[model samples]
Target: MSELAVPAPSRHQLALMIWLAVFPTLTVLNLLLGGWLGDLPVVLRTFVLATIAVPIVVYGIVPRLHRLRARVLRGPHG
Candidate 1:
C-alpha cells in the first residue's frame, strides 16, 4: 500500500490559503467578544458564530485526538 502524501506548498500560495481559510472567522471572534469593537449587525454575528465553530471544534478536539494518536503509535512500551 502507498503512504499518504505530505502536504506541499508554495510560500505565497500557502500563506494566501491560510489567510483565506481563517481570517473571517478570527475577525468575527473578535467582534463576538467585544461591544464597540464588535458593533456588527445581527446577521453578521450569526454567520460569524457559525464560521467560528469550526476552529473552536478543531481546537477543542484536535489536541485530544493528537494525544490519542500519539499514544497508539507509541504503544505501551514507550
Candidate 2:
C-alpha cells in the first residue's frame, strides 16, 4: 500500500483547526436545539453537546478544513 506523506500541523494550527471546527458547530447546534437542551441539567446538556459535536467535527468539518488548508498551501499552481 502507498501512503501520502502530509506534514502534521503545529500545535497552534491544530488548535485553530479544532476551534474552527467546533465553534460554529456548537453555535448552530445550540441555536437549533437550545430550548430542548436548556431544560436539561448543565452536565447532561454538556454531555449531549459533546456527544453530538465530536463526531460532526471530527468526521465532517476537520477533513474539509484539512483539504482547504492543503489547497491553500498548494497555491494556484497546485
- What are the per-model C-alpha RMSD values against the true structure? 10.3, 2.6
Name the lDDT of candidate 1: 0.57
C-alpha lDDT of residue 54 in model 2: 98
Candidate 2 ranges with C-alpha deviation above 4 Å: 1-6
Instruction: List, residue by residue over 1-78, the lDDT tens digit for candidate 2.
Output: 443445778889989999999999999999988999999999999999999999999999999998888777766656
Query: Model 1: per-residue lDDT, tens digit, 1-78?
Result: 543333344677456545554566566566666564367887886676656557654575444444554555556753
Every candidate's lDDT: 0.57, 0.90
Worst 10 residues of 1 by lDDT: 1-10
TM-score of each: 0.35, 0.90
Model 2 CA lDDT for position 56: 100
- Say which candidate scores most in TM-score: 2
Superposed Cα RMSD, model 2 = 2.6
